[model samples]
Target: MIGSKRWCGVAVFLVLLMAGTHVGIGAESLFRHFVKAKGDCLVDGDQPLRFVSFNIPNLLLIEDDMEFVRTNPWRLPVEYEIEDALRAVVQAGGTVARTYTISVAREDDDPGTPKHVLAPGRFNEEAFRAMDLVLAVANRVGVRLLVPLVDNWKWMGGRPQYAAFRGKSPDDFWTDPQLREDFKKTIAFVLNRVNTVTGVRYRDDKAILAWELGNELQQCPREWAEEMASYIKQLDPNHLVAGGVQTHELHDWELESRVIDLVSTHHYEGDPMRMAANIRAAAERARGKKPYYIGEFGFVSAGGIRYVLDRVVRTPNIAGALIWSLRFHNRDGGFYWHSEPAGNRLYRAYHWPGFESGDAYAERAVLGFLRSAAFAIRGLAPPPVEKPDPPHLLPIPDVGHISWRGSVGAYAYVVERAESPQGPWQVVGRWVDDAAVSYASLFSDESAQIGRKYFYRVRALNEAGISAPSNIEGPVTVAELSFVDEFADLQRVFQMGGQVSLGALGARAFKEDLHRLEMSEGAWVRYWVPGEIREVEIRAFGQTDSLSLELAVSADGQEYGPVPVVQRGFRMNGRDYPYRVPVLVSGRIDRPGCHFLQLKAAGALQLGRVEIRYE
Candidate 1:
């Protein structure tokens, strides 16, 4: 699996190309079709408006963590990776995915100041390459993109003069004339770059959503905010621009007032309804300036999703919402529940019935609302979003075992499996309620032989009507499977050291023994070996005393137990030892599922060589 960091770099690059082109259609052509077709306002056609967002730990751009990039290196591979990540969203029904990238001005060469963000566009090869890849990916996947270019990277782009007026203070960065020029240039570079994703050079894609100027501008001086907002409007008239305002900060509104095309807020509090109300009031009080949206909002419980949607949908002028993130880390003390795909929950609930997550209530409630909304949005409706044909549908969605997020009433699809598309079809599973239309039909060929082929199709029924069968995909064969496990070798030889730093020694011969011994300090090496796996082997030996060749094992890599010692009749340097025990021990690593397997020396034995082979 590719690491998330490289994926993030790809997102950053895509944001640079956001304003390249504009769609020719006006608000009437787009939104009229949507309202007539029973779709969302932004989705001017039969398709549901696809909006998705991910919280990329862009800060991790500089940090090193094995978990973030296990197989893929941090240096971006290409622009397509960004598209690849977005493709996942597309498949999940998202037409837009937001990334907190140009949240600030970025410096290319590490400008050496503590407060300066890097302006690496001029010097960083990786940064440039990653940016290029992002455009390519967005073009490939059919999703509109949004990037909040102001925050952290802003102060880095030579806008030191503007920085002086930041926060409540007015004399820090605004006084620097050179800093002001730098900031202007930085904005020009970004605004002028053509977004390859939309085909129109930096000023054209109509599908392009909004260019969020600042993530949250409590520190952004009101004057500078107005200045930048005006510049952006004059610079790119086609796209909407807004600052991703933080909670209820009126100081931000001074800047929020003039520069933004829309008022964007990130609301995720105990009560999303209450939060939405406050923001709605703020937008309304702005008079009839622009639209308002809960650009980002989500909570620890998936149930909060319902509350948020309920409030936003009821608000008169609010356009739509973009969940703060589809997936994020638990390390930051935030919830990670929104990561699930739409069809997952329903399938799980079909099997496990009452599996509750914080958002269970909301997820359950949303299905009926979506069906109602889909039916109600007549002005936006054309033909309804197209579902893939028969061969593309899963024959047996494990509905009973699905999670709540995937259990939408509208997704309940009927799956029919057959030896061939033209032959007899059998209903593998069924859910008839209008809400069931939201359930995705998932099927598998447990009986399918390795190289065997099969075909499938699905049908869904919502209040708008039953969709035509999805397109046919294959009479295709299931191919063999394999895992590259590029880091497998590195994980081995990760030894708990006896006297020296095993990491230092392993670093020298990393290619050779990366898995067996990791650098650690102790008398014995305790390496983690997974159980129920039979493709690998481990063996250890002592060169000196044969009697000291005893071995101990532990379920957890930390605590070890004694293994029966057998005396070998082999003596070294005339020592009366007769232990030449066969080192080919063939017992399974006796640990429970998901437990760690550890091997240790029995006595004060001279550690020789340990080998693992996959046959």
Candidate 2:
């Protein structure tokens, strides 16, 4: 129930981080044995670590900030987020979890940018401290971590970032002598870096399963991998080093390399037959040479995944497998969401226990298969899943604006209301997926009597059943003034014109979330509120930095002109980005009856949410 407690004030960030620090320290006494790579297996003692887990790519720093008009979605997660991620790993019955690439600074980055490696031979203290908590929490939970050193992609600032810093081509990351030595300095910094939370050096931490060179470094030459693997061994003899290339076939030199203890590949081949062939081929290559595993897979059909996992569970040389990715519970509310334009563009990040939005990717069935196969790989039957913990209902001033911190692994939520603090409760709303509203209030009580005082509570639910009721939030009274549309549904009271359409669920482009409306060139959405219009505020995201939106209001839907509105921006990820532009429709001599506020983008913009204050 302590999880339901809330923290407030300007010191909240520091408070949550310090809280995370202590919680991580508590795990120091838990699983501390580093996994070693024996021939064709990774073992803690004599038993190899086999798992059908997931790739929690954002376990350290989250990039999916999709909150309403949030300018930047990049920031370190709080303790609760870490706990939920690792707990999901445990609930899935897995021992080892792999993280995404470690971020590095680039030429374009300023001093304010948050990255693990600031520059060659220079490391960020705060970034590493954030990582220390990640490792600490991993140690506290019964999970081992596989940390990737850097990336080949620009998304996280890796190969090209280093090249830009050194004034060379991106390919120089593999062959150029100066850049190789520079990268070694970065590696040494990480290996020698001590965890501030647990007082354990990176090289000595048992929570780490292996140190991978980089993520999907397919461009890495064979000789460079050998040299770096050996270099890692010299710096950190306590852990194993794995090749981070993205391939279906493991080359002979990789199997024969003396320093490379483990060989792996990422399989996203959607064809079942081809995936099976790749699995068998990779297993044969590492049969008696090195420990082999599926570093990442899935986003394929459920039946296709069944075929692939079946082969993996049966293969002796294939030690384990991890699926593509999952997003955990956010401390503020709901789950953090990410769209993988990479994964058939239909599957976004899967919330644990699954929901209606994930039906397209068979999220429930695939997760069920993962659970059963995870245990089956270890020769055990799947166990029962536990009901979720109580949710944390955030306090609200009005019945129209209601939200709560979601319970991890809970598929849905039910909202209950009572006239008094402790009386008979009434079910106000059922089957609420916090992510379904996507940055909107989780539930709105349109049925609340105007002057009636009310109390609200919520409970999380999934296949295991309903969880205990959340903390009560109360004394909510609807006043005589206000009509707020958080934009959970656009078709309810708005009319669309020109090139405007509801950005459907699973659309990953431009940080698009559920219920968001996308307006292309010359498109407009007219908002009709049945009241005397006093003020209107629109929160939106522009596709381009230069494009602007035109806001106009009319007594009817026809006449329009440039309206007086104030534009605003907020600080995010160390830079100023455009934020909620509160368009103050000033005047008490307002339009009687209904007021129509129409918004149109000259080029393009995505509508996040809207608010209409009227008398």
Top-TM-score structure, candidate number: 2
Model 2 RMSD vs true structure: 7.7
Note the Cα lDDT for every prediction shown. 0.39, 0.74
**Compared with the true structure, what per-residue lDDT tens digits does model 2 show for residues 99-143?**
887798765554455777777888878877888888888877667
Q: What lDDT score is found at residue 258 in candidate 1?
A: 46
TM-score of each: 0.48, 0.84
Model 1 lDDT at residue 243? 64
> Candidate 1 clash total?
120
Give the runs in model 2 whose Cα sits over 4 Å from its true position.
1-24, 395-398, 418-425, 451-455, 474-477, 480-491, 494-501, 518-535, 539-589, 595-610, 613-615
Worst 10 residues of 2 by lDDT: 1-10
lDDT of 1 by residue, 1-615 (tens): 124323433442343234223222121111112111121133323333323333332221211111210211122323222433444344333445565544232222233222222442333434533554454455444455666655532322323324533332223433345555545655666677664333345445443466766566545665666677777778777666766544552334643364555565666554656665666675565434455455665542444555555555555455555554432211211112211223332211111111122233454343333323322222212123333222223222222111111211133455545668785866654642222211111233333334556555556543444555544435755442111111223344445445422221211111111212222223555444332222223322233424333345555556665545333322211111222221223233333332333444445332222322111
Task: Give the worst 10-residue stretch by lDDT in candidate 1.
Answer: 28-37
